[model samples]
Target: MAYPWKSWDRALFSQVAGRHWPGAEPVLPRLSRAADHGRLWGAVAAGMAVVGGPEARRAALRGAGSLALASLTVNTVGKGAFRRARPLLEAVPVIRRLRRQPVTSSFPSGHSASAAAFATGAALESAGWGALLAPVAASVAFSRVYTGVHYPSDVLVGCALGVGAAFAVRAVLPPAPGVPRPGPAVPVPELPGGRGLHVVVNAASGPPPLLSPPAARIAAALPLAEVSECTEDDDLAEQLEKAASLAAGQRGALGVCGGDGTVRLAAAVALRHGLPLAVFPGGTRNHFAADLGLRGVEDTAAAVLERRGARVDVAGTTALDGGARGAAEPFLNTFSIGSYPDLVRVRERWSRRVGAWPASVLAAVHVLRTCRPVDIEINGRPRSVWLLFAGNCRYSSVGLAPVRRRDLADGRLDVRIVDGGPYARTRLLGAALTGVLTRSPVYEAAEVRRLRVRVPGEGVHLACDGEVAPAPRELLLDKVPDGLVVYRGRR
Candidate 1:
């Protein structure tokens, strides 16, 4: 499913593009026909009231403001930096716009840019509120077109500018006052933290929150939350060493705001220091975060500073030093072999542009067509398998289709066979469409304390916590049962 594109009817693009190209008569009106934005903006204001707490509300407002500011800045400042011209104003159908002409230069569509910025910023903080605010944002943008003011291309550029501006604003400011934060498990307190948030911002460990307004929202919300930027070049071990130094001397929990990769990095530091680690959903899929009921990470500072967090079990995978000389290592996510590894390789190449899920789909299709199946024994049961997944928690989603069952805290890891015939393929695809995870005929609930899989391949490539490592033919999977101490909500 090449969504948002592949699924999009190609004809629609042809129709839209047709209007912009050729000696097409101007379907949109001239600049003199612009409409009033006040009425539509009032609707946007009404929608903001529906947000959860003071922090959330503030974030929504700030996001919108940032979005608007970005639009204005680009149209006035950034565009001036480039001195670009509007398509039609130059006497030719320059760009596509359903709206009329703007009094100023039109390198960026302020309406489209601000609308996208507001929608993205708001959604990052509260998905529920974000969804409501979206249509209003759309109407604001659509106004530019309906009034014959801006073109489609102008809005596209504006969208980029707006999103950038929101992120830039969020990076400089703290979360809005009175906004409530989400905990992995616990409810937040009324008062903000007096000491500030001891934030561990790992840039390399995961995606950059500074660019992702949603992730930025969560990080900015922490109280008096002092942010410690963790750069990839800097010694992660050293940075955490410093975090532990501070946490060890202070009172309260250790807050980690990043993806699964970041969590593992920070959690490792927190685990060694004997401090309770709090988790924020900053990763792409965030299977673990979703399983625990944490959503809308637009802002998480308040929750962390308040010491309102939950605890969960961490998964471990032992890796040996070449020649099996050392102890095993622990991992938080899934471990797999064969096709999965190859898929990761391909994803590493494309994930930067399309995103994680899209990369995963590309990987899935690649594996389905190429990689040969594998035969292995899991939990002492031998079977011919195409893929063997050992998950610490549930890693299943049905996309747009209905799911079979979802039990995150069943207190067991899941094992499954990833490939099969067309019937099995249909079942798995159906599950993703509906957010309803299901078991495949090739899949089994192999939630055991210890599992042994004798790999048939010469060198078994394994991934634990999305980290690839070496494994011999005989691979053992075991659960520590509340193994590592992590600060999040329910396990």
Candidate 2:
């Protein structure tokens, strides 16, 4: 006699066999076959990559990767670990049974694992795509049992493994911008059609290829608003200051069109002038704007005209030593020291020639080869580190370099450090490559309201929102809650 759970599994399988799921007979068998060797998920990933935008491409890549991991695990470890035979098909209807039955162990369904992994991975990247793929994944899983290729328990356990595989993949590279919950709403002047809005567009700012030129888009989106273009020769800070002054004088709002670095400067100017900001994502990798729910000029323009705004935390670094004593700089996104700044510098040098993605790979290689550890005291603890990163708010995911932020006004610093030691770089790289960096001894992360960093000798080169600068030996990093107001509609 089999165990009680095994008996229950057979009973459930028999019940499903007896049920008449209208319109499922033809679909279930064919769907099961379609998912053979993860083919169905591969086709979906290819389609997403071809027709979808950046986010879609990311989803597709992550889905395919997760599917691959799930299939590998199922074949290499899962099947060998349990040699359970395929379910007998005598009770299953002939029409519902697969024409060619699977020959491998049936303790866990490989098809079910692939389906769950792909759906979960894609959804982790983009909920909309995940929602569309979820039903299909479920159907594929159920079809395995309906077609008599796997037991109900087999499919269930396989699905659990698949979802775990998806999360494992996310632990490696992570996903895109998180859901934009733009803090608390704040009152601002309504600038319909850009009226009473002063926008300074960075002429050098370049968005993705799909978008039109930043200047043209800003002009078209905010027609009635005052616009100033900052050329390469023009001092960006001066131009931003001038725009903020104009907007303040007119009791309007200040706007900026640029990347994270440019947005940091604009945020500082806006905060100082007591004015609201309109952020147009007109640069490559607009981290700040994307987190603020402004994906493009149109989004910011609509928010401005509709008088929708929110207040977000602003982080600042105050100099405690050197000539810039007491001087302060504010950053809206991220600040880091050590290998990250080196990586940024190297990437910028080669980005124009090889493109952004390849440039990043090259930068990582270059920095890994040439960069050295820095000695610093983190909150009075002396340590040698390869990197130290602090974000304005707590980022959602964890890894060597986490990207998304769920809350902009959390008023906490998301700090991470990579400890330096013998074979430290190699160990760090291996952990990152294997998707287990979060648990690696070399990596450390924490959330704090403030941090005091002191360098051993001369200050290390630090980067704030991708802009590298020489730092003072001693510095204080703290957040100012609800420090900056920006246009962010609830949409």
Locate the minimum summed-lDDT window of 10 residues in model 2.
Answer: 205-214
| Runs off by more than 4 Å, candidate 1 | 1-197, 205-220, 296-299, 319-328, 353-357, 379-382, 394-409, 418-441, 483-491
Per-candidate Cα lDDT values, in order, are 0.55, 0.88
Winner by lDDT = 2
Report the number of backbone clashes for model 1.
59
**Model 1: per-residue lDDT, tens digit, 427-473?**
65565433243444544444566566676556556655565656666
What is the C-alpha lDDT profile of model 2 across 1-491, one tens digit per residue? 24347888999999898888899988999999999877888889889999998789999999999999999999999999888888888988899988898899997889999999999999999999999999999999999988888889999999999999999898776787545677789899978778888889888876344656777887798888988889899999999999999999989999999888998999999989999989988788888888877776788888887888889999999988764569569998888989999999898889889887799999998898999999999989998999999998999877656778889898899999999989999999898888678888999999999999998667579999989998778999998998999888455
How close to the true structure is residue 23 of candidate 2, measured as C-alpha lDDT?
96
Question: Local error of candidate 1 at 100, Å?
Answer: 25
TM-score of each: 0.53, 0.78
